[model samples]
Target: MAEVPIVVHPAIEQGGRAVVVRNEVAGLAHCDREVVEFLRRVGLPLSDDILDDPVWVEWRGGRAHDYEAA
Candidate 1:
């Protein structure tokens, strides 16, 4: 399987929705409105291909350190 390069940041809950920060492909950051537009542009299957990568497991578990701080 090809490794998908992505970074999944901790999800932020705003109002009643959960917003996740993600950096994908060419280091482009996506959150909030950008995420919606990304879904519209790339669609779910490609999005799922990126999201299902094992590299994100550490980030989801909070084991990955904050990238901004480093």
Candidate 2:
């Protein structure tokens, strides 16, 4: 079996690292919007305004990947 590629976006801070890591397997199995909605349904707070920002997305992705803080 081939290893699924992990999609991640790095944070915008100086010296920041990957803040979000999306598992390709899961992402392929489920839609990204659905996943986000699921998180919201599960009481995971998310702000639409924040989502609208590319930097926040990067920061979120990086944080998920346990990247070092900038």
Task: State each candidate's clash count.
Answer: 0, 6
Question: TM-score of model 2 relative to the true fold?
Answer: 0.26
**Which model scores highest in TM-score?**
1
lDDT of 1 by residue, 1-70 (tens): 5443344455333211222334343222233344344445544444444444565322442333332322
Tens digit of lDDT per residue, candidate 2, span 1-70?
4432233344444433331223422221122354355445445456655444454343244344343434
TM-scores vs. true structure, each candidate: 0.27, 0.26
Pick by lDDT: which candidate is best?
A: 2
Candidate RMSDs in order = 8.2, 11.8
Q: Which residue window of length 10 is worst by lDDT in model 1?
A: 12-21
- Quote the lDDT for 67 in model 1: 28
Off by over 4 Å in 1: 1-4, 15-48, 55-58, 61-70
Model-by-model lDDT, in order? Answer: 0.37, 0.39
